[model samples]
Target: MPESDPLQPGSPESDALFELEPRAAETVGFAQLARLPLTELVAPDWAEALAPVEDALREVLAFLAAEAADGHEVLPPPSYLLRAFRQPLAGVRVLIVGQDPYPTPGHAVGLSFAVDGRTRPIPRSLANIYKELDADLGLAPRIHGDLGRWAEQGVLLLNRVMSVRSGAARSHRNRGWEAITAAAISAVADRRTADGGPTPFVAILWGRDAWSVRALLGTAPVIASAHPSPLSASRGFFGSRPFSQANALLQAQGNGTVDWELPPLP
Candidate 1:
């Protein structure tokens, strides 16, 4: 689809899309979606709003369940699947969509490009992201890769496909996660203030995979950049200034700017 005009903060066009239908399945109650340990994966607040798309969520869980049944190992562990939504949904001020979890052991921790703890030798793509972050904000990069701070600051560090087979990248590419995450994106876009005021978010879409979901972000301002891989970082990601640009957009939308700083390494 060709790019449309940038969505105004509270334009009706954007609000209309906020009534998110399941992108790949029918809406149904959680009873039919199985009483799986979904709460263990997604935060309670988000799980309640996501109940409308229980069918798609069910498909995602079923896929993972089947994969586990077949003895296939999934990355980021099971409980961290919806770690992206650990913060309040209404607090989300920005969304960064990644393609999938890192395939390397001890690398995937639900949040995109983030590891479980302060680990050395972060993924190359994440290293590139650090470089861009420094260039964009004139701050020194930290040694650790846990981005939970960004999530707590209202940045939804979501991966379109949340998991992968251990050691195998893109192993779960064609599964139903795309639909489930897409619906989640729309849900965030539709979020309003407690008084029913407009509360738009900024979307930083990196790489082709992330850009593929740009259309679902409603009227939120979008900043697009090439993938932060060494192969492409210099081409566009280096100068993208996504962190600064996202803050600018958030301010323009009448929201508070995000403090993009990561915590210091212990």
Candidate 2:
């Protein structure tokens, strides 16, 4: 179920994203990391759990920053990279993992399969998502591709690999992003809500890349289907009804349903 291209970056081609050995952060100290970009960008909600991997995350960001400083264009404008974590962890009821940020400039809003509200002619993959949403729940497709409303309702729309070089899809894979996101996904699967005997949760895994984390979910209900990309949606994604199935899983655990509705702008 991997993406169309799976060579990934950690191979000898791009060098490992994390190497704190002779060439790594041995000399760097707490006081030094205190001033790095990681402290400024990592949301407080995720700070403590992700602390152990802080150095690796910083290294990943440094690589991206270095790429930008070298005049390469990075998508989602940096600020949006961690936007998915703005919601409290306890509030999250659903997890959706996208392969990576959209390669087209301005098309990736940090959330998987989502774009900025003003983006025109939504990406075909996203359009297919809306089509499935309609078929599954009788919901109308939004004119704008912004999925922020879903995030507000406890839907974590995360990209397994968050950043990418403009016009190059999956160019950042195996570049240390996988390690960071894997921790985040595992944390979500393990969380137990305060005062709740059992918390309800659902994961919508659309493709091989997304399904790769299925083992980490530890029995968390999953709705697996083909990726919604125009290339593969017809194969299995269209009739899967993942949206309805997800709600049923959540309700089975006595939790509230996700508000999948995306109303058009006024």
Candidate 3:
């Protein structure tokens, strides 16, 4: 798929994509074409990689729209639905896959295991991730929970389920979000860097849910561990050293490492 022009000022493409489908179809199926207009929901940088899964993505959005119409609160808001994809994957060297968005209000900021900078007492899983970062890389812990620094430095924080109903964990599972995210993972693995070298990205899969997509990664390196939730951190998540291992994997691919020393958001 060739890239479309960048959306101009006050373009209606954004609004049209988010609007609920006014279709009269009886059954929801993968092959069902979406009536929604997608002007540029995905950045042009990802057009080729994501084109195959676009249909499934639209269906998942339809399910989300229906949920919202039924008064179900969605987490992280719509503006952040594609937040993780804002950066081009060509520069992305690390892929960190999480199960789903945080169900609590104001917690999930579209990136997996990340939240608003001002979110107090960050989610336990994020706290444990901070602890592991310190242990693995000797980086001191900061007061904020935002992971934008890592994202900017080529780490992709993507969740298996892009959206979830507020206050209801895994409420949006079994929807079409999985197929969409699976395609994203495949894009990362199949991506060839500048000069046409082999793909340079590595994947850090957390928990069984995140690990489920491992088969999609053709030859990309992977680091897997139990989820960082309190219940399972003690089992294998605590001392897994995923951060340092991920950095090593990236370096092996001749890519620069992520700056794990994230400062408190200003």
Task: Give the total clashing residue pairs for model 1.
Answer: 0
Candidates in order, TM-scores: namely 0.82, 0.84, 0.85
Off by over 4 Å in 2: 1-40, 194-198
Error of 3 at 67 (Å): 1.0
Off by over 4 Å in 1: 1-34, 37-40, 194-197
Q: Which pairs clash inside model 3?
A: none
Evaluate candidate 1 by giving its C-alpha RMSD to the native, one decimal: 11.9
Clashes of each: 0, 1, 0
Assess the local accuracy of residue 255 in candidate 2 as a C-alpha lDDT between 0 and 100. 85
Q: How does residue 201 of candidate 3 score in lDDT?
A: 81
Alpha-carbon lDDT, every model? 0.74, 0.76, 0.76
Residue 26 CA displacement from its true place in model 1, Å: 32
* TM-score, candidate number 3: 0.85
In the predicted model 1, the residue pairs found to clash are none
lDDT of 1 at 139: 74
- lDDT for each residue of candidate 2 in 1-266, tens digit (9 for 90 to 100): 11112223234311321222222322332223223443344456577657777777877776776666566776665546666776776677999988999999868767888987788889999999999999999999888988878988989998999889999888888889888888888878888768844457899999999999998888788999999999999999999999999998888888878888987861
Ranking by TM-score: 3, 2, 1
User: How large is the C-alpha RMSD of every model relative to the true structure?
Assistant: 11.9, 10.4, 7.2
